[model samples]
Target chain A: MRTMRLNMQNVCLTMVLSLIALGGCDRQATVSTTSVGAASGAPDAAPARKLRIGVSIPAADHGWTAGVNWWAKHASQLYPNVDWSIVSALNPEKQVADIEDLMVKGVDGLVILATESAPLTPVARKAHERGVFIVNVDRGFLEPVADIFIEGDNKAFGRKSAEFIVEKLGGKGSVAILEGIPCTVNTDRVEAAMAVFARHPEIKVLGRQPAMWNRQKALEVTENMLQQYPKIDCLWASDDDMALGAMQAVKEAGRDKEMFIFPGAGMKDVVKMVMDKDPLIPANITYPPSMIATGMHLCVSVLSGEREKIMQYMPRHLMIDVELITPENAKQYYFPDSIY
Target chain B: MRQASTRVLSLTAGGWAPAAALILVITLGFVFHGDRAYFNWNTHRDAMRQASVYGILACGMTAVILAGGIDLSVGSVLALVSVAFSMMSLHRQDSAAMTIPAALMIGAACGGVSGALIAFGRIQPFIVTLAMMVAARGLAKALCGGVKVSRYIQDADGRYIALPVPEAFSRIDARLLGGNIAVVTVIFLACVLVCHVALTRTTWGRRVYALGGNEEASRLSGVPTRMMKVSVYALSGACAAVAGICQAAQLQQGDPEDGAGYELSAIAMVVIGGTRLSGGRGGIGLTLIGVLIVGYIEKILSINNVPEYARLMFTGAIILAAVLLQRRWHPDSEGRG
Candidate 1:
C-alpha cells in the first residue's frame, strides 16, 4: 500500500512538471503572436479571423537547412493576415508528430519541407484528406498529396556545375566529386553529373565520396582525396558548405593554385567568394532554400481567397529554375544579410 | 574453446589489450595501403588532426567513466561552447584570451549543472545528462538563431560585412612544429596528459575509482564521493570546451548543430580502450591508443574511398572486434578504474 502511494505521488509530480512545461510553451506562443501583431499594425487591425498556417521544416543541421528555417520565419512575419506556427524537427518521427499536432490545431494550410519523403507521405495525405491545403517544398512526398509542390531542379544544379567543370578543365583534366547525403536530391544530382562526365571521354573522373553535406566532414574527406590522387585539376563539392570546407583543405595542402572548385547552392558567403573572383571558387550553382518562402507565399494566397489570382502563374507542380552564379552575375543572387 | 579464448585474453590482459588492438588495426593499413595513401606521412598527420577533437572529449570521458558516470551532454556542451565562442570571437571581435576562458566557463557551468543534478538530486547520470543534452542544444540554437555563427556579421545598417577571420581562430587551426603537428593535436595531447595525472597521481582520482568500483563503500570510507563526481564531470566539460574551440577554428564557424552525435564516438573510444563500462578500470593511456586505433581505421577507409555504407559497416565491425579481442575476465580486475 505504501509503495502504491509513492508511485501515485510520482505520477502526480510528473503531471505537474509537464503542465508547467506546456504552460511555458503557451506563454511563448502568446508573446510571439503579440509581437507579430504589433509589427503588422495593431490587434484586430484588418481581418475578421486570421488564417492559421503551419510551417513544418527540418531543424537546421547545416547551412542550407538553416537558410530554409530563417526564410520560413521571415515569410511568417511578412503576412499579417495569417497566423503562422513554425515547428522544426530533428527527425522524421518528430516531424510526423508535429504535423499531427498542427492538424489537431486545425491549421487552414501547411507548408511542409519534409525531413524525408517516404515517412511523411501518409501523414501529408491524411492532412490533404482532412481538407488542409498543403504546399510541399524541396523534398516531395511519395504520393501527390499536396495542393502544390515547389521544388528546385537538383539535376540541373548538378548538370550545370559538371558542365562548367568540364569546360574549365578543357574536357581533359582529372576531376572529382564530393556528394551529399544519400537521398533523392543526392541521387538525382550525382547521377546527373555522372552522366555528364561519361559523355566527355577525355575527362578523367577521379572518384566521388559522400561528405554528408557537412563542412568538417568534407574537409576531412578532401584532405584524404588530395593525398589519394596526386593531381586533381578540378573538383566539384555538390553543396556550398562542402565547397568551403574543401577549399580549406586545399589551402592547407598548399594546392589551391593547382585546381579550382565548383559548388552548388548559392550560399551568400560562397557567392561573395565568386564575386571577388577567388581563384579557388570560380562559380556556383543555385539550389535556393528560399523555395520555402515561395511555398509559404502560395499557402497564404490560396487560403486568403486569392486562389484564382495565383493560379494564373502557379501550377500543381512548380519546378523552379536553377542557374549558375559567376563572378559577373553573382551580385544579382547575393543577399549578404540573409543567413545561410 | 572457452579455455583457449580465455588464455588468449589473458595474454593481452591489463594495458596490453589496447596496444595490441592498435597494432592490429595499424596492420590493416599495411594490408590495404589505399593506393599508397596510407604510406604518406601527411595522411597520418591529417588523421591525428581529425581525431584530436574526439580525443579531447575522450580524455574527459575517461574521468567520468572512472567515476561510474556517463555524460551524454558532452556533445551538446561542445555545440554550446562552439556557438558561444564563435559569437564572441566573430561578431563581438573578442580576443582568444577573452573568449577561451569565457567559453570554458560556459561549458563547465553546463557540466556543473548536470553534476549537481546527479550528485545532489540523486538522479541517474544518464537521465540528468540526457536532459542537459537537450537543454544545451536548445540553448545553443536559441543563442545563434538556428544558424551558423560565421565571419559574416550584419552591421547596424543591415548590410552583411565580412569580418576578417580572427587571429585566434587561424592560430588555433594552424599547424605547428614545422607543419608536422596541428596545434589542435597538441592541445588534445595536453588534455590527455592532464587527465592522466589527475587519474593516476591524485587522491581525488583514487576516490573516483573507488566510487565507481563500489559507491556505497566509497561514501562510507569518507571519500566525499559526491564532490568527486561533480569535479570529474566539470573536467569532462572543460575538455569538451577545448574540443569545441578546436572545432570552431577548423570549421571557421560556430554551428549550433555541431557535435550532434559525438558522445557515442567518445564513449566508443573509452570502451575500445579496454575500459569497462561498469566503470572501474581504465586509464588515459589506454584511451590514447584507442584514439589512434579509431583514427587510423577511419583514415585508411577514407583514403581507400570506401563507400559510405561500407565505411559504416567496417567501422562498426572493427570497433566491435577490437573491444571483443580486449575483453578480459581476470579475477583481479575489480580494484581500478
Candidate 2:
C-alpha cells in the first residue's frame, strides 16, 4: 500500500511537471511571434500594429463541423497580414475558456462559431464590451453580442427539400424522415419539413427516426425502416452523412428504384452523386459549412479594409443564400477537395 | 447433501436469468412490434448485424471482467484504430495485410499499457482505463486532423481525386450465408467463440477467475497474476481493434468520433448478462444473450419510430430490470458459487 501511494505521487508529480513545461513553451512561442510582429511593424513606419484575429469554433465532432474547420483554416491562410489563432473546443465551457484566452491575448477581432448559444453568449458579450470586433457564425449567440452575425437558413433547407420531395412524388407517395441530432438546427428543419408534409394531405408520413446525423446509425435505422414499411417512396435525410447511409441501405435492400433521397448540408460526395444523376440521390439542399469561411472573410474585411466604405456596404446580419443542388446546378457547388 | 442440492439449484437459476431477460424483451417486441416487423427474419438479421460491433467489444469486456478488471478505453481505442485503418487504406493506399495488423497492434498496445498500469503501478483499473479513454480519443483526432478519413484525396493543383475503395472494405461489409448474415456478424460470433473457449477450457482461464475471486490466494498459489491481468486487457484491446475495422468498413470512412459512448453499451451488455461487476461470475454465453436483448430493444424502438428521448428512457428501464433479475441468484450463493 505504501509503495502504491508513492507510485501514484510520482505519477502526479510527472504529469504536473510536463504540464508546466508545456505552458512555458506556449508562452515562449507567443512572445516570439509578438516580437516578430513588432519587428515587421518597425519597418512600416505606420501607427498600425498587425491585426491579430482569434477564431473560436466547436471542434470537428462530425462531417459538417470538420468542413467548418477546414474552411476556417483555408480562409485564415488567404490573409497573411492578419495573425490568426484558431482554437477548437469540444464543448461550451472549453469554448468559453478559449475565448477568454483569446481576449487576454489581445486580439483585434474574434470570429466565433459557438458550440452552444446560451453558454457562449456572455463571454461573447464580454468581448464585445471590451471593444473587440465580433463576427458570429452559424449557431448565433443568445444576446446581440456580435458585430456581424452570419447563419444559414435551416428552416428553408427543410422546407425546400420537403417541397422538392413532394413535387417529385406527385404529392401522394409515402415518405420516411431520417432526422439529425435534436438541436435547434434539427428542430427548425424537422418542424418546417413536417409543416410542408402537412400541406399535402395525400402524402402519408410513415415516421421520423433520429439517426443523430451519423452514417452507421442511419444505415441501421434505415434497414429496419425498410423492413417495416414495404414501400417508402421518398426519404428525407436531414444531413448528408445520414443521406449516404440511407442510400446504402436502400441499395442493399434493392429498393433504390422505389424511392429518391433528399439530404441537406451539401456534402461534396452527395453533391457529386447528384451531379452524376444517381437514381437514389436526386437532390440536396445547401446548409453549407463554407459559411464559416464567409464569416472569416467578413472579419478580415472589417479589420483590414477601408472601414468607412466596408461599413457602408456590410449589414449587421447576413444570411447566406441556401439553394437546391440538382443535376443542373450541382457542378457550381461541388468542392472536390473539401473534407466534408 | 441438501446444501449441495441448493447450490446446484441456484447455479442453474443464475444461468437461466439472462435468458429470461432476453425472452421478456422479445415479448415486449412482440407486443409493440412495428406492424409485425419483429417477426421478419431480415429484421432479426439486421439486428444481429447492428449488435455485432458492440458484441465484439463485449467479448473482451467479459474476459477483463472475469479477471476482475474493467476496460473503458475500448470505445476510444476502436475510434483510433478506425482512423488508423482509414488513413492507411484510403490515403496511404496500404494493403489490408499491412493496415489490419498495424491497427490491431496499436489497439493492443493501448490496452497493454492500461493493464500494466493497473497491475504494476497498483492504480485502480477504472482510473487507468478512463485515462486511456481520453488520451486515445485525443490521439485519434490528432491522427485524422479532426476530420473523417474517406476515399477522397487531394492531388497537386488542389483538386480532389476519387480513389477506388480497397477491396477489403467491401468484403468485410458484405452479407454472407445466402445473404442472411453480415460478414461483421460472423466476425463477432468468431470472437465470442474464441473468448468462450479461452475462459472455459484452459487452465489460464481458471487462473483468471481465481484471480478475480481471490487475488492474494491466486498469487500465493503460483499464478502469474500481473501477467494475466495485462493479457486480459490486451485481449480486450484486440477485440476493440477488430470492431474498429468493422466500423470503418460498414461506414466506408474512418470517423474519429465513431465509437463515442459505445463503452457504456459494452459495459451494460456485460452486466445485463448476469455478470457481476464485482467480478469472477460471468461467461461469454450470457453476454451473447445480453447483446441480443439490447439489440432487439433498439431495433423495436427504431422500427416503431419511438422518439429519441423515449428510446433512451426505455433502454435505461430495461437495463435496470435485467440487472435486478440477475441479482436474485446472488444473495443465495454470496458465500460461494
Candidate 3:
C-alpha cells in the first residue's frame, strides 16, 4: 500500500513537469504568432511602426540549415509585430544579392548566416549603414557587421573529439581524418585536431579526406581508404552523419575490430551508440542543433530592450562549449525522439 | 559490301574498346593490388554488384532518350516507391508473401502517374518531369513524415528476423559470388534482355525508334507517338522505383532524401553512353558500359585517397569530356571520319 502511494506520487510529479513543459511551448507559440501577425500587418491598431526583419540564411540543402529555417519561422511566429522576410541562398554571391534585396526592402533588422566571411562583410556593413539590427549566426563576416553573433565553437568540438579518440586509443594509433564542407568551421576543427595530434607524434594521420558532409560520398571514400590502407586504428570524421557513413563502410568491409570512428555532432544515433559502448563508436562530441534556439533567444532579448547586456557596437562572437559524450555521460545527450 | 563490312567493323571497335579497357584496368588493379586477402575476387565482384543499381537506372534512361524524351523524375519515383514499400512493410509487421508484390505495385502506380502526365498533358517532358522531381520528393517526405524509417521485423520469439530474400534469387547474391551481388543485378539483366528484344524485334520498338528519328514522319505514318512517349516515361519511372526499393532494402531504411541528385547521375550516364540529349539514338548495352565506367572511376578515385570535392570535380570533368567526345562523334560530322 505504501509502495503504491509512492508510485502515484511519482506519476503525479511527472505529469506536473510535463504540463509545465507544454505550457512553456504554448507561450512560445503564442509569442511567435502575435509577433508574426503584427509584422505582416494583420489588424493591429496602434499607429504601427513597421519593423522589417530581414533573415539571410543558407539554403536547406542539409540538416543544420533545415533546422535554421525552422527556427527562423518559429521566431517569426512569436514576433508578429515585426515584418519578417527570409531569403535563403547557397553561394556567397547569391547571399549578398539576398542581403541587398532585403536592404532595398527597407528592413529594420537583419539576421544573416553568411555562406562565407570576406565577400559578405561589405554587404553586412551596408545593411548596418542603413541602421539595420544585424544578428549574425554561425559564420561571421570578415568585418564586424552584426551587433550580436551567435555560433558553436568548432575548435572546441574538434578538441573534444580528438581527446576522446586519444584516450580510447591509449594515446597512440594511426588516425584518418574526414573533413566537412570547406569553411571556417572545417578549417577551425582541422586545426584544433592537428593541435591535439601535435602532442603525440606516435598518432600518425594515415589519410585525410573531405567527405563534403555527404554520407554516400563518405562511404565510398572510406571504402577506398580501407582498401588502400592495411589498417586504420581510428577515423575522426568531422561530422556525425559522415561518421555514420564511414562506420557503415568499415562494417561492410568487416573491419570493425581495427577501426574506432567518432564524429563531432551529437546526433541521437551516435549518442545511442556511445551509451551502448558500441565497439566501433565509443564517443562523440556535442555540437547541438539547438544552437538555433540560442540565436532565437538572443534575437528576442535584443528586441525586448534588454540591449544593455547585448553588445551592439562590433560583432559579439559567442562560442558554445562542446561537451564530450562517452558511455558514462551519453544519457545526457540521448533524445530517442529528436528529429535531428 | 566492303563499305558495309567496314562500318560494322568500326561500330564493333567503338563498342569493344571500352569493354576491353574496362577489363584491362580491372586486371591491372588486381595484378598490382591482388592477393587472396587484398584485391580478391570478392572485391571486383562486390563493385560490379553495387554498380548494377545505377546500371539498371541507366538502362531505363537509355530507352527514354532513344524515344527522344527525358524523364528527370526517375530518381524521385525511386524515393517514393522505396518509402511506400518500407512503410507498407512496417505496417504489415511481416515480410510475408505480399510485401514484394505490394512494393512493385506501388512503383508501377508512380510510373503510371508520370506516364499519364507526359502522354496526355502535352507538356515538355523536361518541365513535366522537373515538376515531378519536386512533387514526388515532397510526397515521399510527407508520407514518411520527413524522417528516416527503418523496417525491422521481430519473430514470435522476439529475435529480429533476417532480411527477406526470395529463394530462387539467393544464389545470385551468395557471398561466394560476392556478398555485394544484389537481386537488383538479376532484375537489371532481365530488364536489359526484355528491352533489347522489344527495341530490336517488336513493332512497338521499331515505332519508338522511327518516332524518335522523325516525329512528324512517324505521325504521318500513323504511329501512336503520344502513347509510345507515355509508355517509355512510365517504363523509366518503374525502373527507378525498382532501383529505389532495392536500395531501401540494402540500406534497411526508407530515407525520404534517398536518391537525392541521382537523376542528374542517371542522365549523365545515359549521355556518356553515347545517347544524344537532343532526343533519340542510344541502346541499353551502351548504358551498361557507361554505368561500369562511372562506377569504376568512383571506386578507383576513392582508393587513391582523392578528397571528396576533388572527386566531384573529377566526375564533372569526365562528364564534360564524354559529352565533348559525343559531339565530336556526331554522325553528321564528317571531320571524325
Off by over 4 Å in 1: A1-340, B1-13, B154-160, B329-337
> What lDDT is obtained when candidate 2 is compared to the true structure?
0.80
Q: After superposition, how far is residue A108 of candidate 2 from its true place, in Å?
A: 55
Ranking by TM-score: 2, 1, 3
TM-score of each: 0.51, 0.52, 0.48
Model 2 is docked with a DockQ of 0.01
Off by over 4 Å in 2: A1-340, B1-12, B154-161, B332-337
RMSD of each: 24.1, 24.0, 26.4
Candidate 1 is graded, for docking, as incorrect
Model 2 lDDT tens row, A1-340: 6566445434533443343234334434543533345455665588588887888988888889889989987887787677777777765544765675566557789999998665476578779998899999988775688989998888888888889999999989899999987566787788888999999999999999999998899999999999999999999888999998998999999998898888888889889999999988888888988888888888888988775578787898987778999899999999888887
> Which is superior by TM-score, 1 or 3?
1
lDDT of 3 at A52: 60
How would you encode candidate 1's per-residue C-alpha lDDT over B219-325 as one tens digit per residue? Answer: 99798988888898898899889999988876667878789888989998887777767776667888898899888766655544332344556566556654444
Better of 2 and 3 by lDDT: 2
Off by over 4 Å in 3: A1-340, B1-17, B20-38, B94-97, B152-180, B331-337
